[model samples]
Target: MAGHDLDRSLGLYPTMMISMGAMIGSGIFVLPALGYKKAGPAVILAYLVAAAVVLPAALSKAEMATAMPESGGTYLYIDRALGPLFGTIAGIGAWFSLVFKSSFALVGLGAYLLLFAPISQGAVVYVALALAVLVVALNVSGTKMSGQIQAVIVTLVVAGLLAYVVNAGFVADAGRYAPFTTHGGSGIITAAAFVFVSYAGVTKIASVAEEVKDPGKNLPRAMLGSMAIMTLLYIGVVGAIIGLSDPEVLKTGGPGGTASLTPMADGAGALLGGAGVLFISVIAVVALTSMANAGVLSSSRFPLAMSRDDLLPSSLQTIDARFKTPRNAVLLTGVVLLLLIAFVPVIELAKLASAFQILVFSFENMALVAFRVADVPSYEPEFKAPGYPFVQVFGFVAGIALLTQMGTVPILGAVGIILGSALVYVAYGRPRTDRTGAIGTILRARRGEEDDGIAATEPE
Candidate 1:
């Protein structure tokens, strides 16, 4: 709570767009083919399963956001609920997870560009770097500017996707539905784990809850509405791709052979010819850019929140007087994104990012259960997640189950992250921070004392 707070400039539509925009990016255009590869036509089921798994976490976050309404999103919630040690871990983990996902989008931006021009790999890296810088600059300019850009981009991307799905519906072959479970039940589950990152956008919205126009009602509505919309869109687009294209053609591998890399364009080409390819390719660029923009908007707040708690460099807490933005944190995020694009492959970064998200989501579920069990008087949320412990428990169990299916590399990466964050906290965070966490809040409430001033207040 030092430095200038973020401006409450975003409204319902912009907030909803941020959630939807972050989720609909490069993943939808490319991952469908990889999903298909893993689960065959049954990948559509994987999308549904992943969405269902994410629903509880979404509800938990929505309720938590209304209660806290702070800048850090999951990191803030976990820190307050679980205490400083776990908070440090969540702060760092959330930052890198989002950075990894943004880097994935930037690299995908480069790949989408390749569809238009024969760009060299070095050129693609530079393009991604440049785009990252531009997005950082936009965020630094102001949150309103960023929200406006998101609205425009999200509108265009959704319109294009709807068109593609409609056209695909007309041309889709009914016979392609046969042998739906090409890889069997296990493959569908595996694919669900692999693609779960697609829903991470819903949580991203919570990161900016402090900047929303109306926290009590807007936060929950935006989170739930965006998740519902994105789920339908994902299923529709994937269904269209499955119905319109041959499994053999989608599975072909080599330079430009795998539909996994360009499912939207490829499926469009089959349905509407070259014109469709060009159309979807353009929309792909817009969609990926929107994701990067929203990612930067959401991820930079982690450092800002940590800085406020004395866990990160105080410089990151500095806000631009003119634009009222966290300039230092935004620039640092851009720098890390550029380095990640240069050093890591998109596939590896994506898998690791997805794994980290599942871990953070599991923690969110735990945080909700902790709050409910404590039953603190001051911890009232305007929008409570229905089903109480049952929904939260299912989310926690399903999140961990999905993590198990992610294979060895991402699993190891998550473990390494946890260990690294623990070391950082013990060495630096423990000495400087003195905030009372959720458990302490409950104890105080039990004694008829005021909760830490973190709970949401009604607008004047």
Candidate 2:
């Protein structure tokens, strides 16, 4: 088990579905009203803005993944490029971001379940935790099994969303766009910052790069392809909601304001009546489940990769002999997610998740630039990101800008977490590890000394 590796069993379609599934969860189902509350009908622009910012990060991640083609996604790239300290932040940050996002999806799942059956809030929490356990179990079984489930869930979710969008379009009222920026440019930017979590899934596919067949081609295709599709889906969904429902009605909250809680369902109900509510509810279940499944599959890899690097307990790196999956890592991720779902407030968790992801994206952009400037011979990637440093520079800048818009609490929370991670790395991780990452190689090269094992070349 210690020597085993994840099987390269996922193909292009499953990989793409994994990305789509991770993204199209509670964000689309529940975040519309939140976005609208922040920017009214201009929330569509928020989605677009978020996508634009995420694009360069996506391409940068793809290029890095092609060069590394390993697990841990952003964690591995940042570790290799910036060294272990930043890598520690990225590893912990990526873990918590995905866990919180998955917890959000599970909580949303509980809410959707209540529509079908009356249940106490405690019961809902229990049910959500139970479902998270199930998702982890499926992931621990095998990546192929998880990928198959994701493909099915993504198909159902996309079809339901398309139906809702089309139905709402036929009955659209353009008047909702009257006060586009009710909260002003700052509001729109803030909303974009929050909803930016929706696009975080695009890079998640890279976490499983070790298990992706022909990762050089498939990784970039899956990341970019899913990002493109989800962008269109989000924009269309937001447009349909704004067109089919009154902004004031969408903004209402409470038990009576289920519309605000589930905007897509409300829009569908407005277009097709009660049956549409049931339809969208079904989509909600599938969408949230897909997200939880994909989240567990991807997030578990961070701990696995860290353990392999001796940054974490060696137990976490244990691969199940039969399934070829990191069972311990999957269990740990599931347990943490269950705790978050049961204990943390959903809104704060969502905000922090978005904030941490932005930080991770910023680091990824920096990693790409660092590696390119370092010009390590092993840094050769089959699929280079188009536009070079410009794209990465823009991504880095945009990510920081969005981070600033998240307000004080999440910003402070992220800083504290980063500081805490750095402390842990110095006290525990640094002494155990001897490998100097890409940055160390640069320093050694500057001194005309042998730079570890990888040969270095002058920047092209």
Candidate 3:
């Protein structure tokens, strides 16, 4: 594989914040409402199912990230354990997922902006694209700046959740959430399947393994910690919404349904006063900005990966010697994200992204198994999955189950991605540099001592 450079300015704290920032975004404030629309009051069960699937997946990624301790997150895992073909496929699948999800974040941005700006309300399309552009610009500057922005965004996320928990967790009526199963069992399960996309960003933490400190420890902690935090917040926020409203009112695909968080927040206001709605609105806006912040940070690394591998034009891998950042790659990432804003909806993009990521994650789990079975002596993972193969097995099954639940469109979407990647491989997967460890290892060795230390090389 052709070698390329990336800045190492991102560290454990910043990277963890990046992952946390990404995971906490629209999934908390936005997807819950979308899930409510899909399954009504029974959405609580959906949260459980989503968390069940994603927790294991996160653990699986933690294991793989520790083993690889390099860039490309799961992409490196698959390349080493499986082969270059599978790795390339995994990379494409994951990259596509991030792209789609980032665009969906912009959709939320547009929706939230419309709520506050009358002009934005009239120009939702333009505003969504504009938010995408703005976020892209922020990320393109450099990883250090991105981390600082994410720090601010993550703070707002915490404050927003704090607001919701205080008023709704304490003051809301309980009877409104009655029976809890009002949305039907299967519907709740389906909604959970959809909401799994909320957890998608958690694995993105592993993408910058080399840039982090004490990665094996901190990455796992951040992965599991953020998941727990978000899960609790989700339960609280959704609990508040349900506690304050009749399921039938927030209900959708039925007789009387408003089917948005707005209705739920309005009900909270009725019970807790207008201050409750104000609280929800403020959090909602913060959620929008933070979600965008998350989207831009992790995604800019992809073009760097592809360029370094020669899968994309080499220009993308260029690093500014002064800043040590891949400005070209960041710009390309933004342009692609911007183009996606016009066409996709949050739920649709969420489903598609979920399917794509599930495929990559499943392979990553399998990679753990493959590496152990192959006994490749050069690699000894610092953090291994507890139960070794069993946890990975559980993760694999969970991914399959979620994919099954996605029905036809998502499944086909995943299949199409793999097939498209295969076609690309047939054409461009040459020199087999895209191969497992051979070319990448060879290139890194050749550049040893000739490098400025900015080259992305695995340490022997």
Using lDDT, give the best candidate's number: 2
Model 1, runs deviating above 4 Å? 1-18, 119-126, 137-149, 204-225, 246-249, 252-259, 320-325, 440-460
Q: Write the per-residue lDDT of candidate 1 for residues 1-460, one digit (tens) a residue.
A: 3667778888888889878877888668767777788888899889888888888888888788777755567888888777777888888888988898888787777767777887543466677777777777888897565556767878888888998899899988888878889889889988898788888777767666667887767877787788888888888898998887767756762134433456776667765665887898899888887777778887898999988877787999999899899999998998888888888765667778888888888888988887776665667876688888999999999988988887898899889989998988888888987655666666777899776624421110
- Candidate 1 CA-lDDT value: 0.79
lDDT of candidate 2? Answer: 0.80
Sort by lDDT, top down from the best: 2, 1, 3
Please report how far candidate 1 places residue 251 from its true position, in Å: 4.0
Candidate lDDT values, in order: 0.79, 0.80, 0.67
TM-score of each: 0.86, 0.88, 0.81
Largest TM-score belongs to which candidate? 2
Deviation in angstroms for 137 in model 3? Answer: 2.7
User: Model 2, which residues run further than 4 Å from truth?
Assistant: 1-18, 119-126, 137-149, 205-225, 246-249, 252-259, 320-325, 453-460
Q: List candidate 3 stretches off by more than 4 Å.
A: 1-19, 119-123, 146-152, 204-222, 245-273, 320-328, 431-460
**Each candidate structure's count of clashing pairs:** 0, 0, 0
Candidate 2, clashing residue pairs? none
